[model samples]
Target: MRIERLRATPVAVPYVHDEIWAFGRRRGQVSVLLEVETDEGVTGLGEAAAYPSADIVLAVLRSVEPLVLGEDPFAIERLMRRIELIGTWHHVKATSPAIAAVEMACWDIVGKVCGQPLVNLLGGRFRERVECFFYVARSDPAEVAREARRASESGFSTCYLKVGSDEPNTDIERVEALRDGAGPSARLRIDANEAWAPGTAVRMIRELARFDLELVEQPVSGRNLDELGYVRSRVEVPLLANEASWTRHEQLAVLKAGAADVLSVDNQMDGGLLNLKRSAGMCEAAGLPVVKHSLGELGVALAAAVHAIAATPNFTYANQAYGALLSDDITEGFGGGVAGYTDGHVDVPAEPGLGVTLDPDRVARYAELYRTEGAAFSFGDPDPVLRSPALPKF
Candidate 1:
């Protein structure tokens, strides 16, 4: 079927906790939902990771709409090549997310057309359900402890805590509280978000090693693989590369350099599901485990991740699904509304396509919010300084 129409709607969904990370505090989550309708009456849905700004993402999506309007939906490879050509010709990174959204929609259409779930199209299911880790955002130590306790009680086996703040001592305290409150059984992972230098990361990982952390993620800048290797060699805890390995080329570079013990992959950063799968295959070949990364995504993206993780064989670590962090979601119709973890695992929906449906009314409501209130921050803007002591430059 020929692609007929492409519609993109920007939505601003409130975060449940107003999470604070190394970069800044996020009061709300923003994304642009893309709907691709074919002439044969089949429609597909996807989400663009707009993050700090939805306007830019919308503009990019609109710019690429003409290239995809009359093409066949099933020609994903050819379409992606054209999208990449346009992106490279324009010298714009924003086009990546826009292309990813459209590519995902095409995959959704393919899955629905075949009467199979997205996972089935990706080489069948490897597991019945995908396990997700509880994400503890930056907060007071006491508050972190409380949330850790709640996560344990709620059947979560692992909790990922945000660290790498200005005060190293306070970050240590938060980890201690989380360790104590989460008990001995629950695993804890820390993400520095590239807020520390190699030396600082080494020192901090040495101090935090007493708590038995499952992994430490992106302690150093994404640009320095040598520094990452330095930190990884000194620390006992496994160091995971997040921002450093956004693309397949980066993934290979990190793997070749032996910079990290594990790699984190995400659909948004890798461009699309097929690209993520390819990255996972590379990691699998290198005998490294792949963990899924979350960018405080809504249901549309979360569903896509769930499907990808379910089909991926090397995805052993507890994946992050921040859908529970949202106050409301637009994908409520197909069981994508509120994020729920059952005994620390999220069930993969067996329904056709991406297994999530969008509610037009809710989309309209959030779209109105996007137009009126705009965004709280822009990805292009400088990261908000949360404390006084600046992070050490590499």
Candidate 2:
């Protein structure tokens, strides 16, 4: 059956507590909601978020729908390939975010068609739950330790600490305390958010190496690979690449350069499931592990990651996929589209097609928080070479 209609709605939700982290805040959940209607009368829903403007993301959704509209939703790989072909030529930065939403909806459609959960469709679950890595934002070392301890108590054996926010010494103390709080049993992972200089990254990783951190992520800047490689060579701790690797070529380059040990794939930034699988396959070939990086994803995206990870072989690591810790707004109560995390690990969702459904009443209330105020709007200029007629009628 062919896709008949597509829709995207961006929603924003306020942070209920200390929901803000180094990357952004829970100040709002700006998710791009999607609905894909098939000619056979099957409708599927999906959700994701964009760091870029909602208008731009919406435009991306609008642009890509036409290419796949009259195509078979069950022919996922072929549909993805078509979308990628169009994305490569058009310079659509939000292609992955848009594709992820659409791809998920397609998967949902397939699952409904087959009368199976997405996990069953993708393959089958290797494990009931995916291990989680708790996230501790920039804070006092003691506070960081406390949070780590709490996460450990909850069954999460891994904790991802946000560093490079302060001086090297202060960062050192926090790492030490984080390790201490995690008490050696829990793995300690640090993310710099591309906040350090190359020289400083080398120094910081070298100093923090004594704590035996599970990995130090993007210690140096993401823009400079030579510097990244240089820092990677000098650090004893495993250097995990998060923001640095994006497309296939970039991931291959990072691996060939001996820059990273772990591949942290963000489903949104790195395109959709198909691209993520491609990247994970590359990592598996290289004998490296893959983990999904969370960017404040809700139940739908999180569930997709779990299913993807379960399907892929050699994903030998836990991901920082704990969005529930950052927000209790998943009012569906941990099954019907609500993600649950304990001790930094999440039990795999058993629902068909992400199994989580948003509470319409809550969604209506929260969507009001989405503001276009101060948004630097960009009516994207279509690529000169590959412009197609707008399918959604703009």
Candidate 3:
């Protein structure tokens, strides 16, 4: 069936707590939800993280309408090719989330038409449930400890926290506090967001090793693979690549450099689910595991990734997710916050397509929220000084 029109809605879902990273803080996640209607009266749902900004993602959808209109929804590969080569978005990585949303919609259509779940279409289930980690909002040592305790009590085995504050000692103190609160059994993961220098990363990771961190993410800058390799070689903690591996090409470069122990992959950052599978295959060949990275997504996007992760082997670690942070979800009953998960894991829906239905009322509520106070949820710190910090804060 021919494609008809794409409906895009921008929504801002509030977070239980402000997600504070090295660069900025967001009170919630901004997702550009999409629905593609085909001439055959089939509707496919998709979601895009407002990477960079929501305005840019909206503009991309508008720009890509002409390329996507009148195409066959089943011709996903051909449709994507036109959007990439003819539309000339191959090199423009920033437009990936919008393009990915459209591609995800097409896949949803295919799944519905075939009367099979997305997991079956991609590959048979390797695992029934996909595990995720709890994201602890960065705060003072006491607060960090409390959040870690909460995560442990919630039955989450893995807890993630952002490091790389201006003062190195502050980050160390928080890590120590998280370890103390999470106790010995829980796995601790820290993301520095390219905030440390090679020397500083080595020193900081060595000190933080006392807490027995499961993984250290992007301590040094992602731009230079040598720097990542330098820090990785000196530290015993495994390095998970983020900025260094946004696309397949960059992932290949990272593999060649032998920079990271574990790689972070995202369907939104690359293109779509097919590429997500390809990324897993490429990393699997290298005998390395991949963790799904988030630009901060909600139910629709999370469900889409869950199918792929459930079907694919080698998603060895509990990937990054926003469930611990989101105050609510737009979906009906599934995939919003910690409540959507059962013991730190999300089960793939057994129904067709993405298998999660949007609660239009909640969607409208969040859409109105996006309309009125969208600025508060963006990836920018309200504090002017915190908005722009010198990278490699030693």
Q: List all candidate RMSDs to the true structure.
A: 2.4, 7.8, 1.1
Q: How far is candidate 2 from the true structure (C-alpha RMSD, Å)?
A: 7.8
Give the per-residue lDDT digits (tens) of candidate 3, residues 40-148: 9999999999988899999989989999999998999898889899889997753469999999889889989998889998897999999999998967999999988
- Among these predictions, the greatest lDDT belongs to 3
lDDT of 2 by residue, 53-88 (tens): 566668878778778788888998888778778656
Candidate 2: regions farther than 4 A off: 16-26, 87-95, 335-339, 371-394
Best by TM-score: 3
> Could you tell me which 10 consecutive residues in candidate 3 have the lowest summed lDDT?
380-389
Ranked by TM-score from best down, the candidates are: 3, 1, 2
The segments of candidate 3 whose C-alpha lies over 4 angstroms from its true place after superposition are 384-387
Clashes of 1: 0
For model 1, the local distance difference test gives 0.82
Q: Using Cα atoms with residue i matched to residue i, what is each candidate's TM-score against the true structure?
A: 0.94, 0.86, 0.98
